[model samples]
Target: EAATATATAAAGDDGGGAWRVVGGDASADGGESPTRGDASRLSRAVDVWSLGCVLYGVLDADEHPYGSWFEREVNVINGKRNLDRIKHLPEAHALITALIEEAPTARPSAVEALEHPFFWPDARRLQFIQEVSDRLDKITVDNPMLDSLEGRSSAVFGHRGWQVVLKPSLLEDAGKHRYYRPHSVRDLLRLIRNKRHHYRELAKPLQLELGDNAGAFYRYFAHPSRFPGLLMAVYAFATEYLAHEPLFAGYLGPETARRYAADAKERCASAGASEEDMLAAEEAARAAALLSGDTLQETRREWFPREDAWGDAARFSVSSAAAAREAAGALGSAAGLPPVGGPAGAAAA
Candidate 1:
């Protein structure tokens, strides 16, 4: 009887048994599977897939990832996993998805899998951000890496930028730094980079002040869900700017960084070195004109003949006091409050 059964199995006859072994070369969705002799299919990636299935089962009430037993083998072969139940858990979902990628070569190694953001602590995440910021400080403005960082930061944090998202007190403290500039995300990162670089060299009193002020900054990252893109953006920024392999590439994917690099290269090729120099010269000229109070209606037309007229706009000035008053007035107006020195403001105070 045993010899007869073995011969029947070898002849592809399961006899309707519920526990029959499914061959690895099972096809699904009319797609061809790897031949039985293909040794490339047998790899650590198989273990990664198994690990993913186990994790999915553990997270989803011990249920099989591919479905019922009868369909499980087919679904696994087709790379059709039912992750609906655990989809709400972004980090876990991401890790599992990468682990079970259809292409065996696409799956992360065991060590890379362990480094996923899903496994990171809040402290480590913060440290990661600090390290990236430090690395970015060494990059020049002309580097495409800064452009990539700026683009990603804008997408994650918004065009209003990181300054607006941070606490008012923290912003104020940042302004006091020698390298302070509130114009862009690059400026904010540079400020942090400079402060952090000299932090240990500072006096104890200054160090404590810096730490106390940065408490809210740290708290900002404590609840990442509130800022969904914060960690991913930082990770992407690091991957591109620091020339480091992505730690959370499985989450955000490495395609974005590659696309940015490609786009940057294309733009440079199309613009050529002479065009870039000309553009830079024009920008410097505009800045010089604005600072020299030469952007008045008549002067602007004279200096930048192709540019539009200021059209009765107020004269542009670099006067600090005037800029402060203008900013204060704008804030007061937006809040429906009177100017700072007015009777209504005094009474409200």
Candidate 2:
């Protein structure tokens, strides 16, 4: 029970905390049989089984396929459980089951689990897994826009022309020892000035169509706003539909990027904002977004970081598994394993 005691001590308080290292536990089942090497391997197999369970939980957003952990473990030990309940359990469940065999000697080693077809999959899954495994180099940026100079800076820049930059502290990573150089206000504004032409084109249409509804979007971007409903709508739709699109990563979704772009066309037709104004707002958001500081902040924030109106970013952010599949359908291949899908029609427009 020494390993069990150590693991129990290592578990510390059961109160969930910000950091946790999900790993294997030794010394369970009364520390019976096997040498240190065999015990370590057996311990890892238990950890893998636990991980398979946790992976299912996370994939299901905390829902357990067998109802509860206690119940699931009981059922599993009773030989009354099957792993197929996990939405996309993959064939790896078989390999994991083999690893978790009741008899210590029967359990597969971690090395064996790693080599299983479930882990390796076919070429596509292999490519995606390798990409995700190597995603440390991928950059996703999210940002909030700063308050515009109103009409004053507008005169300095242009009616539609604008610039944006992020504060540098946002780029700092607690995990990294090296510090990031913060961008100066001058650097941000200047970049905005230089990129203004490119962005104004995107804002033009939105500025015209939604009129006042459009102002809220820009205001939210300029500074973090307490109210971000409209902006969130825009960000969600865009990220879902366009995250993979190269030009649009850091840039907020174009007003036209909505899952139902036609709905926007209808809105514009009803509002009667001239095409010019709509174009102005859309381009303004895009241009400023391109030049926005939050973009850089978000870029540093996640593996797939994209600034939402709420200002949160994440890599491997939780998403509707079905939506991921639809996205895969749209993109021609699932980025990795079919993400655990949310409820049906979860990713639909």
Candidate 3:
């Protein structure tokens, strides 16, 4: 996944070769580059704008708002204020323009990005975003994809183009139109339906955030061990250290935490470990870590996914050898010391 992400980024950069070049003629006939003329150094800003275009393209399946190529150029020249050009904007189109502004200084910083009007208008609106968040959560895999397909299969294939490998079937169908491998009508229907289904499954449960500019959470997920592993590590820490009640409420939510605590308690009962035993285990581990000369707690802290992102260092109590192994494995590492081997063993050390 990491390799794929790096390759994709490189592809993105390379495909926009005219973007990197300093000068050309913006006013000239049919120059592909946006920064061809005056303010060419401001091309970096065009990259930001193209990023917005790419985001919209993915979200809406590569439909340009402008009706035609000429219309697109006109809108770009007028800074895209023409309502006819963007009549279908679902949210603030101004925000998109803000990020894609031809002027570099007009763009927002990474940190200030989260607070953009495009995110939510005000604190109250932001709080209301929980509603948008919920509705977004409810947006199934089918909705967007189903909406994107408007019986335009032939046009889609024409636009995207198709490739076929040289194969025995081609030789067998030689001199016939079948040799060229045009998709059957049934094939096109099946292809569109399958794509819609695939994208629907792909987009569910995702969240988007704005930073330095804006991108979706799924973008980070595309990179290996970048965000999901970090999230899991934090979740593991919350379970290991904090009392179940407070830990659940603080990390997840009050309602969720309470439900989980009840679940955990039930699991404890089923396992024959009394509440007293659990408390005793926690207390003993905390004490042993504090009294010992070694920074056992810091060793555990290294398991956190985004430990480097946290400003302050935090610690975990040294557990039994088995418990330590469990912790290590949960954070996607191998178990090291045994839980009952020796003085260093986790057996309630």
Candidate 4:
């Protein structure tokens, strides 16, 4: 059994003092250090909290995440974090919030912390969108994942029409995919599914033409206001998915697959599986995941030319009429229909 110690700090003028660690060795100055077993049990969580504080200080110009020193421990105990200064940085703000969770179990481990969206590159962010879109395609209307996505989407895009946030030319392109009215997040998801399916079916020339405008398309979801939630939602889903289906985790990335595979191997050993059988199972899992293909990676390569392109412009630059005309021409050439502004197109108009 590990001994428990209490540390006390001088009370403020109001007679309040900081909180103390519960399991540690007594110290002369009233500080405490955890004993071996206690350290193993508590250090990771305590370290996460400390790191959160350090991150908050660094990001917010040395401002504490909790309030003043007198009230800091109390605020922390009450789950009151002073995150105002870091709100402008949504990913960092979210990471700090999770890191400083009052429940030790709720705080992410160090490995998970490094995997947070705050550290993701633009390409990974784009891959997240692709994965979410693919997953949305397979889920039913009543799926709980839909509810999660809906709540997040509503927070950012509101319950009203998404057209307000989208460019007219983008909407026009959506119309070409038979998605004329995107009234909600579900509607937006449907539009994405339709467009991606159509993009896959398009001739090389048409695909290239539309792919050139992929940045414009991505802007609707990746806008500054919506991106943080997008990243978080995908992260949440991926975490859940990885836990349940570690075997197919290759869809996320090779590194993630390798990590999950190690865990799976341990589970197999615990279950008393033979080494040969475990190796065979691992090979089969890898083969299945490979056969399924990684839609996100494929979409990322086809759509985004460079990571920098994601942030090069605040808005999609092409005019509505020009974009519509160019897209229509590309589709027309691919499908053997008359070009935009030609006699047949003029007659139809």
lDDT of 2: 0.34
lDDT scores in order = 0.50, 0.34, 0.35, 0.51
User: Candidate 4: minimum summed lDDT over ten consecutive residues — where?
Assistant: 1-10
Most accurate candidate by lDDT: 4
Error of 1 at 115 (Å): 3.2
Candidate 2 residue-wise lDDT, 1-349, digit = tens: 3223322222221334321122323233332344678546545655655554455545555554344544643445343435555513424445445543444445545554554445432332323222221221111121111111121232232233222232222222211333222222222222322222233343454334312332333332233221112222223333333333333332423332333345434543443332333343344333323322433233223322223321211211224433333333332222222332244324232
lDDT of 3 by residue, 204-293 (tens): 322111111122322232123222222222232222322154423343445435434665555434433333444544544544444323
Residue 293 displacement in candidate 2 (angstroms): 76
Error of 4 at 103 (Å): 1.9
TM-score of structure candidate 1: 0.46
Clash numbers, per candidate: 0, 42, 8, 0
Q: How do the predictions measure up, each by TM-score?
A: 0.46, 0.24, 0.22, 0.55
Residues 1-349, candidate 1: write the lDDT tens digits. Answer: 2222322232222334222112333323333334455324443656676777777767886566677766665565455667878755656877888877766556777776776777876556655666666544433455455676676655455665565555566555556665454445566555555655566755565566456444443444334433445556666555443322243233333553343445434543343322233344344334334332322233334323322212111223323434433433444454464544444323322
Q: What is the C-alpha RMSD of each candidate to the true structure, in Å?
A: 14.2, 24.2, 23.9, 16.9
The weakest ten consecutive residues by lDDT in model 3 span: 205-214
Q: Rank the candidates by lDDT, best first.
A: 4, 1, 3, 2
